[model samples]
Target: MNIIELFEELKIDKNNILLASPEDIIRIEKQINVEKRINPDIDVNVANNLILALKDYRQELYFIASNRILYTLFSKKNYSRHHFPPLQREYDAEKIQSFINQFLNDDLVLYFDQNLSQNKFDMINDIFDFKNCFPEDALFQLNKKLNIKLDSVLVNLSQNNSENNSAISYVEYRSFYVLLSYFSSIEMDDKIRSLVNIVSERYNANKLSDFYTTCISSMQGYVAFDPGLTSILVRNREAAVSNSIERSSSGSSSGMSGKSIFFIVIAVLKVLFLFAKCSSH
Candidate 1:
């Protein structure tokens, strides 16, 4: 199939298209390279797949980021009080998603892809094991899991882009910090501290400091999700991080507690695989 036809089959539309033209693709990629320059270890394999899954993975973040942010805004600018104000073509679908793509690509998206490859996923293995035969295996893992879940709700803040034109909402990040807490240590805390500092500075969001302080103060460790949920590119799960959000159709959220966080983690896992499935195709 030609590129245009392939994109159409992928259900590409004006709203989701970051690459409106060949030039757009090149410009987006240059943005990815800047991150690699800063952190050489970061694998930007997502860019390789961006061309492939323009509609695939987004790395899976767009759905989560967009749902939290724009759902209410896009629900209707038609309202007056307590509603999004009149948009001046600044908040259209393409620009909004594009903004998310650019913001995530910088340091957040690949950061997630790189981190997931870390040993943290072993915890998810514990969770996914479900261990029907040994239900405790998954049940065995809830303590650390739930703590990190608390951290996620408290720490994560999602906005579609840097322009500050999109909506910002509390979204769930990747649930790997439980691993740091489970195996608490100087190195883990230090690594996350560096990341949090960078993320906080880039986004100019203070919630991250909550994570940074908590994470370093003790082995409490913070919960941060995959920003690549709104990022571009694809990395081979095997070669990059072993693998890798919510809201696009997360349906709705109720009370958030350790119990709720537990369900959220599983939900995130389902979403991750959903993206993985898209990548496979």
Candidate 2:
């Protein structure tokens, strides 16, 4: 079936397409591929629209799928059970890794195409949103897979526009740091850390430090922050103090000690001063 015909078959309005389940998505892809194979002269616009829609639907589906997998692996109740039986734990870990790997591989192909666009970048951002929710080990594996894909994209983009002097945009820079933060959130192997250091050095050192700190602050209550990476990034005494102050203020408020309250007050004052400085500039 063609794009329009497929939508007709699905009985969904093209303008208000709801999320499709994985099974329905796979079937739609198959139908579209078959149609293209049978009719090489299919309208380009229709094909492109269908492909873009498919990407949107797939992103939602993948996000839900990844969240479910992570919940199964890292729920509080499973934590103790995952550790007690050594062999079974190993087996389960392998299974979980394999499942996650399949999802990542499929997602990479779906989202990262030869013609990179804003949509692809948005897909990466969405993936990171859910990927960060995973525990350290799983997050590490996901980060590795994602970084490999992103590196390939960067290489292709560079080769394709060798003479272009345009710098990465603000949104791209923000997304890049999100990926970096996730990668650094887990304990890294020597090789991975070396690779990350190289990537980190590509950006302005001070800007990178600020970006990393901002990322940590934004994700504060959502996921566990890795102090290991933060310590390495925020080396200046003043920035380190500011980060500690913010962290203390943003943390749970129950049963606060006098020192904690004092830090919160200082943090608020510092924030106000920073805002005034920016406004003045």
Please report the TM-score between candidate 1 and the true structure.
0.21
Among these predictions, the greatest lDDT belongs to 2
Clashes of each: 11, 0
Can you write out model 2's per-residue Cα lDDT over 1-281, one digit (the tens) per residue?
23433344333432223455667657766776676677776655656555555565443323322243332222212223332222211123343344344333333333334213442444455544344333355444555665664455355333534232243232134454444454553333222233233323332133324443343233221221444333333332233345456556767423234553454334334434443454475
Give the residue spans of candidate 1 off by over 4 A: 1-19, 39-41, 46-61, 69-281
Global lDDT for candidate 2?
Answer: 0.40
In terms of TM-score, the best-performing candidate is 2
Span of 10 residues, lowest total lDDT, candidate 2: 82-91
What's the CA RMSD of model 2 in angstroms?
16.2
* lDDT of model 2, residue 118: 44
Q: Candidate 2 regions off by >4 Å? A: 1-9, 12-108, 113-122, 127-172, 185-226, 234-281
The C-alpha local distance difference test score for the whole of candidate 1 amounts to 0.34
Please, what is the whole-model Cα lDDT of each candidate in the order they appear?
Answer: 0.34, 0.40
